[model samples]
Target: MEEEKRTVRAVERALDVLLCFASRHEWGLTEIAGRVGLHKSTVHRLLATLEDKGFVTRDAATDKYRLGLSVLELSAHLFRSDDPSVVLLPEMEKLRDEISETISLYVRDRSERVRIQAVQSMQAIRRVATVGARLPLSVGASSKVLLAFANDGDRETVLADPSWPAQLDLQTFAKQLDEIVSTGYATSFEEREPGAAAVAAPIFNRSGKLVAALAVSGPSNRLTPDRMHEYAPAIIESAHRMGALLG
Candidate 1:
């Protein structure tokens, strides 16, 4: 009897060709072939198969191949299954209860901050920041917490924008970032919305990378300087605990 094959070299080669896109957005046939250590003919065949399966697409003019929507669909399903927002719900609820103020989780999105989750205060006189709301990173407490911990490249990207905070120059922004890093939190008094005040702390993953911001917000009258100073340590502690619970 003929010996059974333990592995298909062709399939492995095809997979290598696909993975070549991990570091590159697009590649020509020759470039992919070289990167995957496969012959040009082999890479071409693999690209044809991948394109047929909607895992890759070819640019007609540039003769390059790019990842296709199939990858996005797979990633979307994976992310939806274990959303970080799910972990945030209980922590945000705890914060809202502790402070009796609106609590929101914001993530950096390009040049802005997007509210991904929120728990409103129990009191009638409270501020309510809705989920799915997007605001500029230049003007809010939560946004600033994210900004303070952002990678240098990301911070520069935001600061380079024409709409960056008009009141703060580069030197002032750098100094403020230093302060936020030292304190591990930030505050904004009616900086984004009128009559609103918020205090925020950076939420890190288990790896100590900034992932999100947890903020307590309320009316400017109630979230006074004294109250902000009073609640800041609690907010920072909550952020620390919440980060420990994150995956």
Candidate 2:
């Protein structure tokens, strides 16, 4: 039992060391040790093991550590394996063709939302959605849908985060989440980026667990509020279909 506890603790500490990089791109051994509240020798041992696994790299000249390519490689593997976005690519393409706007699939990553896949609009004037791009969970149609369907604890954690809009009223945000849950979709007008507009719907698994959000985004000039409302039904239907395929 003690051995098992030690093993779990070791894993937790290693993960803590890795997560420290989320705040900064690089870290020195002493800095990492202080951040994780571990001794320098223990941190060095953990870094050595992590380096062997290609999860982190140490600079030869500066002795600083940064995330390795293996992290991105693993993220790519995650997108290909059992990810609903990969399975729903055809649907996203069809939606893009139908709406003539950018169709993106977003998944919540802690307090952030990440675009896993995107089908860009063919028009010259359109919002560009890039895969693997991380956006704040505080705004945007996709972020609203992702947060609305999230568990209560996670929802609160994200909203209370220091990165969330300080001036935005929590009560109003709560009402917005409730509205999304009741309506089965969300729409945003220049909430995240000026001149960018989007409408999104939640995608769920066979177990009714919210998995990802399907968003149709474009320039406000083209995807106006009225047009977004018009596209809401199609986006909701496509999201439902995508969820069904997750089984």
Candidate 3:
């Protein structure tokens, strides 16, 4: 994020152009210039530089630009190099031991949330979420926090899905998501699985992008609505520690 504090206007303008591509796939010269509030000439120069570096590509017939293969390659590199579960296992184990509840780490995958890592509680009646288990975006504290903090485009993609709970209308769903963002956490009581209850907090990278959710789950008999609040501070603290390590 230090780069964002830079005095270089050229770098900032170029980055602004790249950000414009996140909301849309293709952009004409005029459209890109208008979005970034730069002159067409300046945008043209920036696009040429970005094109030379393989960060963007221009369509010959349509005279529009899209992200280039190099950008995809960079994204691939980031995924390959940034495996959070490996770095977070120790802290997760510590949290699990302290709380005596199942600790699960989930990341957003399209419109679903997938448990990428988990440490089960010792109790025989504890709730369990296996690694690689995909759960709906509409249910569970883990999934809701992911949806709540996701980028606007990703959030829209999940919201527009037919499976997003019909019981809650779009505006109601939006308000719930906004509440999660405001509170810094979310809770569920058998929303996804019978008798299960959970409290989840968002985990973010240093750049402030949410990367995952850390949740603690157990049987509703033990982790009832009243007791869920007791575990909130612990989960939120663990999320902060893990998120700081991510940076």
List the global CA lDDT of all models.
Answer: 0.86, 0.92, 0.88
Q: Write the per-residue lDDT of candidate 1 for residues 1-247, one digit (tens) a residue.
A: 1222424666788789877876678999999878878789878888999999999999999998999989888867654534667777887898888899999989998988988888999998999777767888878889889889998898988889887768777788778987998988899998877899999999988998888998999999999878998999999999998888876
Per-model TM values vs. the true structure? 0.66, 0.72, 0.66
After superposition on all C-alphas, the RMSD of every candidate to the true structure, in Å, is 11.9, 4.7, 12.5
lDDT of 1 at 37: 82
Better of 1 and 2 by TM-score: 2
Per-residue lDDT for 54-122 in model 3, tens only? 999999999999999889888665533368877788888999999999999999888888888899999
lDDT of 2: 0.92
What ordering of candidates by lDDT runs from best to worst?
2, 3, 1
lDDT digits (tens) for residues 1-247 of candidate 2: 9999999999999999998987788999999999999999999999999999999999999999999988988877675547676789999999999999999999999989999899999999988887878888888999999999999999999888888778889999999999999999999998877999999999998899999999999999889999999999998999888989897
Top candidate on lDDT is 2
Best by TM-score: 2
Please give the range of 10 consecutive residues that has the lowest summed lDDT in model 2: 76-85
> In candidate 2, residue 146 scores what lDDT?
95
Instruction: Give candidate 3 regions above 4 Å deviation.
Output: 1-81
Higher-scoring candidate on lDDT, 1 or 2: 2
